[model samples]
Target: MLELVVHPRVSARHPQLSDEDVRVAWQNSFFQALRTGSKNSPEYLWIGIDGKGREIEMVGVPTATGYLIYHANTPLSKRVRDEVKGRRT
Candidate 1:
């Protein structure tokens, strides 16, 4: 199991999500993409279902130990949901 380091900003920005919610989402990630073209560290976008069965979207960078999640949200846009569902089929 990879270590999970959630940035403080995650909770600050998304008060509805708890640390455990983020962890479950990461562990259950069904769709992930490497996000390039940033001047900073390489980042990744992950979409997964939490234990409560809610879809969660997370953005973060990989760390030597594991992954550092900086952002997380729910109820993805219709376009994104459609795209992800299409990929699964």
Candidate 2:
């Protein structure tokens, strides 16, 4: 008998990420923007795209700056938070 270890899917369409996947992607892109210093818009409103190239903005951002957009539930958020917290220690 062969054992097959099933792993959770990590794609954008994965079921687990149905609600937060796009938000996470946008957050990642926002971080890239911040890293590159492209500050035309400091805030990142969430967005979604259909297969036909239609884009729908999900949320709104009144004001923001830097990589803070990826905070809370994002992967980059923890690293960024730790880095900032470390500076004060």
Candidate 3:
């Protein structure tokens, strides 16, 4: 059997983005802007990741946390679950 792995990597330019730029990118990609907060003086934004690690499709930057993700191309959650199950020996 062949194992498949998929990971989404944000380009270096993403972190370099100004808050506004990040917002724009977020809006364009996810159709919403994320809220910003700080913990321990470090600013962090909450972005939702599905089981496959891909941001939810077409859902706006969630005003709150706990977004439920579903299939876009393939069911990533199942794949991730399979990977996890495989690792448990």
Give the best candidate by TM-score.
Answer: 1
- Which is superior by TM-score, 1 or 3? 1
User: Candidates sorted by TM-score, descending order?
Assistant: 1, 3, 2
TM-score of each prediction: 0.82, 0.20, 0.20
Task: Kindly list the per-residue Cα lDDT of model 3 for residues 4-60, writing each as its tens digit.
Answer: 111122223233323333233333442222223323222212233333345422112
Candidate 1 vs candidate 2, lDDT winner: 1
Candidate 1 collision pairs:
none
Q: Judged by lDDT against the true structure, how good is candidate 1? A: 0.84
Better of 1 and 3 by lDDT: 1
Clash counts per candidate, in order, are: 0, 0, 0
- Per-residue error at 43 for model 3, in Å? 17
Candidate order by lDDT, decreasing, is 1, 2, 3
**Highest lDDT against the true fold, candidate:** 1
TM-score, cand. 1: 0.82
Error of 2 at 50 (Å): 25
Task: Summarize candidate 1's per-residue lDDT along 1-89 as a digit string, tens digits.
Answer: 67999888888888888889999989999889776755545978799899999899888888888999988888776766675677678
